[model samples]
Target: MDHAETITLADGARIATWTRAGPAEAPHVVLLHGGPGLWDYLEPLAGLIGDEATTHRYDQRGCGASSPSDEQSVARSVADLDELRAHWELDRFVPIGHSFGATLALAYAAAYPERVPAVGYVSGVGIGDWRTPFRNERRRRAEPFAARLAELSVPQRTADEEVKWRTLTWATDYADLTIGLRAASAMAHSPHVINQHANRAVSFTDADQIGWAAAVRCPVYVVHGTADPRPAANALQLADRLARPRKRVVTEAGHLPWIEQPEQLRELLAEIVQAGRC
Candidate 1:
């Protein structure tokens, strides 16, 4: 947390951002947390690789301390990232994206390949139809918490209910069920609201995915956890589409590999960031 500030975009959307300093000569890396609606939750990840590269993270628009707005679109999100890059005076940087952020990072790289040296894709929902399988797997895994989770899914919920709901909903995302509830609860932080609009705006069709994959010229490192409800096969397909791609599947880890396998994820990210300097 070396630096934290609010960056006001030209379109009047203010994004809350944080920067952690690393070695002065190290390349810059931007960590894009999952969830179009959820606030930033990559601080631990930033700290893990702080010795190797300067790390940047932000709460997407309408999330956390960022100004709330419904004007969400993939183009707007890319523009905001570019503005942040200009503000930081970075010529180029590696983008490490998780879940939905992985897709967003790809979109950004496709739009401005020159500004992006590489991309780190973690737990991304890849091209084609992946949601059906993910939902089926999650449903089976979440059976124990199903009743309570359903009760908490109403449009309006108390803060405690929000936390509980999120915890139950995300409990299936971990390889170890014993620690899953606790981890998910801890992640259900402030601004409990989920920007459904933002989530809808950033989705990629099969065509969009293939086009972006073909458009991006930089190297892409795709990593997925074996135990993650989201199938790693999708990530494999995405990696295959890239011109320069590196793929890894971590055994026994969950959707958020940094939490389950920090050392491995750190090493991989360090490699990607170092490549950005080339």
Candidate 2:
């Protein structure tokens, strides 16, 4: 929360960036929030790190405060990160990515293994067949709101209705309905639009992800939540592919561990930063 600025990419896309001050010699940690289209929402998670490590977070091109673009792909996103690291003058850093962002982080590491000391993959849906099970579990959990959710999911919806629809849909990501509803409501921030094209274009299948993992030369922390409907087994699949993967599972946590288990996630990230320093 200390600094904010906008950086222009080679493609002329403007990306909004933020920074939190930490020790000059501390490990640099770049946080990648999930969603191919959603804006940055890792402020709380970033706050947990405090001054332990210098942190940089930004809206992916065409998301949040970033400029929209007709071109979106995994390669472009990885290139963007490398550009940002150069702009930030970071020699090396750890990329902690959540959800889809986790996949992006892995791709970055694979593309530039020399610049990445480690990677944090949190709540990621690995390149496995987790989508089917996730959908089934989400369907079971969302039975109470199914009718309304379907109604609001139509092509045209008022802004308010869109938020409602998103809340109901995302609420299924939590194990506790009460906390899930509250957290999902907060995540339903304004200007929220899911870029279906970006989601599809920037994603990787398990087969391709495995190929990418082969190129990664650093250690990867594959962190997952036990109660996260996405199936922790998917995380294991990703871990198995990494050259050096450390898997951690948070008990009773849904998708976003920072919300339900801030201290635990904080400890894990702190450990990662410290390890990167060594």
TM-score winner: 2
The TM-score of predicted model 1 comes to 0.96
- Per-model TM-score, in order, reads 0.96, 0.97
Q: For candidate 2, lDDT tens digit of each residue in 124-181?
A: 8886689899999999999998999988979898889988988999999997878999
Q: Report RMSD (Å) for each prediction in the order shown.
A: 1.3, 1.1
- What digit string (tens of lDDT, one per residue) describes model 1 on residues 124-215? 98876688999999999888878888899899988888888888888789998777878887887555577777777665587887889999
- For candidate 1, list the clashing residue pairs, or say none: none
Assess each prediction's global lDDT (C-alpha) against the native: 0.85, 0.87
Count of backbone collisions within predicted model 1: 0
